[model samples]
Target: MLIKTFENKRIGIDELTGQVISGVTFLNCDFSKVDLSETEFVDCIFYDSDRQLGCNFRSAKMKGASFKRCDLSVCAFNFVSALGLEISECKAQGADFSSASFMNVISHKSWFCSAYINKSNLAYTNFSKVNLERCELWDNRWTGANVTGASFSGSDLSGGEFNSFDWQSADFTGCDLTDSELGDLDIRTVNLEGVKVSRDQMSELASRLGINVLG
Candidate 1:
């Protein structure tokens, strides 16, 4: 816990529990509502930080950081690497990224509920309107990702690798794409009601469920 660059520094409600902040460098820092529960930030560097409303980056590394509007709830980024991060509208609940390595990250409208991202490596991420309820993204890759209106309720994307993604209005209810790879992608107005798709993803969504494939 060695904070440098002490300008406009306001480490609010500091509790720094179980602290182990290595090589700290927080320029323009303002850790608002900071509890930092079970904190352990190795190789820490948070430039222009602004975390408010019950902040706790539990088991944090936050590699290559740039966080904005942070409100990391029940945060326990298990095995956290957080590669190339840039978070916005953050309110990550029960956050426990099982095997975390979010490469090229860019989170917008974030609120990862019940998060426990299993075997994670969300490649080229750009999660818009993110709200992964009951999340446990198994074997996640999400190549070239741009998950629009993301909301995978009861998520457990088994053996995941959704390549070339642009999942429009995404909402995979009760999600569990076993051995996942929703190929030939163009899920228009995406809202697979009670989603648990298999059988070759219902013959690749039967020609966009009979026309109107995003017009």
Candidate 2:
């Protein structure tokens, strides 16, 4: 079903499940308390047109969905499978994205402060210039993700697998990187000021930098 020009409408939960919606223009629509499980949306636009009312996609299965310049701060994407999702210039502060599996996702110039991405698998995702300040990213499989210019200030990134990504442009100010698997990361450009890393991890970085580990 291709839903278009849908504005200021309160859609019930019964009309969302098992529907394959494309090119949906849901501006200022109320999707709160709505169960979007088993629903697939493609090329959809959820914006706040002349209003700041929020939308919810908690536990929804949204594959190839895209949202631009929207304030999805109140949306709870917990346990959702949003493959190839694209969100630009959006704010999702304090939202819950825990246990979500989002592959090839791109979020640019967006704010996700205090958000939870715990136990999520976001491999191959691109988060260039995104504000991830104070977010909970524990136990996430975030390998091969482009985090250039992304802020991790005051965030808990414990047990995250960071494989071969650009660490130079990532801000680690006051961030907890305990038990994070940073394989062969160059510390020459990484911001380790006030960053909380394990002793073993520090030694590993020192050893890679040709610093004396003995004495």
Residue 157 of model 2, lDDT score: 84
lDDT for 56 in candidate 1 is 31
lDDT of 2: 0.62
> Candidate 1: TM-score?
0.27
The lDDT per prediction is 0.53, 0.62
Candidate whose TM-score is highest: 2
Q: Each model's TM-score?
A: 0.27, 0.51
> Which pairs of residues have clashing backbones in candidate 1?
none
Once superposed on the true structure, which residue ranges of model 2 sit more than 4 Å away at CA? 1-112
Top candidate when judged by lDDT against the true structure = 2
| Candidate 2: pairs in clash | none
- For residues 1-215, write the lDDT of model 1, one tens digit per residue: 54444444666454454466655555444553344544555444443335422333433555444433343333334444454444433334333344444433357744334444444445645455555555566766676555566677777887778777665546777788777887555555666667776666666677666832331
Per-candidate RMSD, Å = 13.7, 12.4
* Candidate 2, 5-42: lDDT as tens digits: 77778778668865766667777676654555445555
